[model samples]
Target: MNRKQPIFYLCSDALGDTAEMVVKATMQQFAVDEVNIKRYHYIQTEEEIYALILDAQENGGIVAYTLVEPNLREVMKRSAIEHDVQAIDIIGPLMQAYIDTFNDSPKEMPGLQYELDAKYYNRIEAIDFAVKYDDGKNIGGLLAADIVLVGVSRTSKTPLSIYLAHKGIKVANLPLIPGIAPPSEIFTLQNTLIVGLTMDPNHLLKVRTERLKVIGLPNTTSYTEYEPVKSELNYGNMIMKQLMCPVINVSNKSIEEAAVEILGLMNKK
Candidate 1:
């Protein structure tokens, strides 16, 4: 006989995001397909919890819940046991552990994790700022940015800027070309961290060559040539020296690794 599709019933006092995440992650560990995830959010009363447990039991679904209220959780537990349904508490054990270890009580509020507060708003604004000022589109963003990234092509400037921006740091990145002078505003920035990104010339050449192939362009262009790549690196190094900012060689660093280093430098400054 063919097996029935696996079903997960997610219950939460707020948006069912927490329970849904846990269910999805657990699903990844199994080779199951056609899995159904049903989210029941804003659960309040004991009747609602029992209803959800009954639904799960009828559908042969497992329940994963992040209910913050102790009474609601008790109802869910009891109903699941009475109805022979499997129920997993996503946050209760962790909350209990925190209470035991730290001798503290939780606020037990729902949707606190998804609060649209100042930090959330700031992160959104930073993301917009990163997009608007990306690739030196507007040099004026230099003065307003929390971090300014200057680098030659394929130096991970754009990715690093976006990563930092997601952490609520407004970042502006500018490409350093061989013959082009950077914006004058970059020279006069106050209270902004300027980071220079560089990569090994040979590695950059390989990356550029692959980029050309991916874009159906010829590798004969100066972009993929060793001499021009070396010149661009030399010019970038010179500009970094003139700016007197810290330089990061992104030759073997991932975006996460580079972002951590940049954050450390930011803390030091």
Candidate 2:
């Protein structure tokens, strides 16, 4: 006879995403594979809780639940004990802790974090705007953008733009290639913050060299050579001087650090 896989019953009055996330995170600590997870969402009545407890008892499964209503939680606990089922309260202890520590009560609402509000819609719109105007694809975005990034290649422009968009700031980036004039719209911006990104020549050469290797291009290509890299940086610096925007040296900074600097500038503006 083969051993059956252990099942986990996730019960909730709402979408049950919170219990599912906790279950997934706990599974990472275990070595076992092929554990079954069954989700029961929008569970409201005592009869529904009894049915789920019966199912768990039959399958020798453990129940993990995020029940907000005291009546539903009491029924789940009583039935689980009566049927000899192991039940874990995912959020009940945390709620109690908050009440004990701060003497405050939760609203006992489910899926409040997932509510679609103005900030959520703004983030979605900003992310869409980032994708639509990425890499200088649409010059028109320059005028409407909250911040504009101008840099040579491999300065983390695209990732930075997406990160900023997550914070609900619309960002557009343009690559400052040597001898390629940027769009005329870049010069007319009055309200947008134009940020210049530059990297050390040696760091850029190493980065571009690795990039070429990953893409199966020759290391001898001008894109990775010292002279061409220096020329690109110099040209980028000249453009930044013309625009008189704040420049960020990304040679030793992380995306988060650079973002903090940019966000500070935005706050000051």
Candidate 3:
């Protein structure tokens, strides 16, 4: 028998996006109801809450909503019971207690203002390009980069790029396609430090095959055969050798370790 999966519909304009992303991240950690969780946002009024309740009822799962207003909270609680769904109002109790217990301490207001400014003062932008094509992207402006990474395709380039980027590195990755030759501009960028990433031939072939299938491409020998991978790696290594670039084998390295290694490389340079 299938277990009763608990689904929540969170509702808060201020906390909506961050809360939804948090729940989504948490869902991945759970084996139960991992795929069943969803979030609803921008719920400020009673009608909006009621609409979400109706939606959750048809699905027959828990309906967790949040509200800032006291009157709306009461309305939602009644609606939740009427819909026969488990409901959780995330804000009511916390707000009541906070109001009752806290004094008007305007002295801490400056610190709070400072904290808010510090938290979001330097949010990073999305990496518009995928990591598989990083070898082709230019990092000439990456002197602001906390760490830079270079590697051939499917060698965990995208994840590492995102990871280092999250750590405040304006990480620019260039994907190296063996025998295709890196563009001439890459050779001229002496200001930016580079690290070469390589992986085992067989493992790369397997990963490439899976990626090709997902993109509806043919898993042909030309794209992921052992010889082609080995040749590519050889060419990449030769290019790095000629350039006197430091190389790292990433087949066994975790994302954190790769980022750390890159940081060390940058520090040494």
By TM-score, the best candidate is 1
Runs of candidate 1 with Cα error greater than 4 angstroms are 1-65, 71-90, 101-103, 209-220
Candidate 3, residue 136: the lDDT equals 49
Over 36-65, each residue of candidate 1 has an lDDT whose tens digit, in order, gives: 998899888888888888888888999999
Backbone clashes in candidate 3 total: 5
* Cα lDDT, all candidates: 0.91, 0.91, 0.66
Can you write out model 3's per-residue Cα lDDT over 128-162, one digit (the tens) per residue? 33232344455443343434455677888678877
Regions of model 2 farther than 4 Å from truth:
1-104
Which has the better TM-score: candidate 1, or candidate 2?
Answer: 1
Model 3: weakest 10-residue lDDT segment is: 105-114
CA lDDT for candidate 3: 0.66
* lDDT at 221, model 2: 71
Q: Output the number of the lDDT-best candidate.
A: 2
- Pairs clashing within candidate 1: none
Residue-level lDDT of model 2, residues 1-269, one tens digit each, is: 12778788999998888888898889889877866899999898899999999999889888999998888899999999999999999999999998999999788777776689999999999999999999999878898899999999998899999999999999999999988999988988999999999999999988888888899887777888898889999999999999999999998788989999999999999
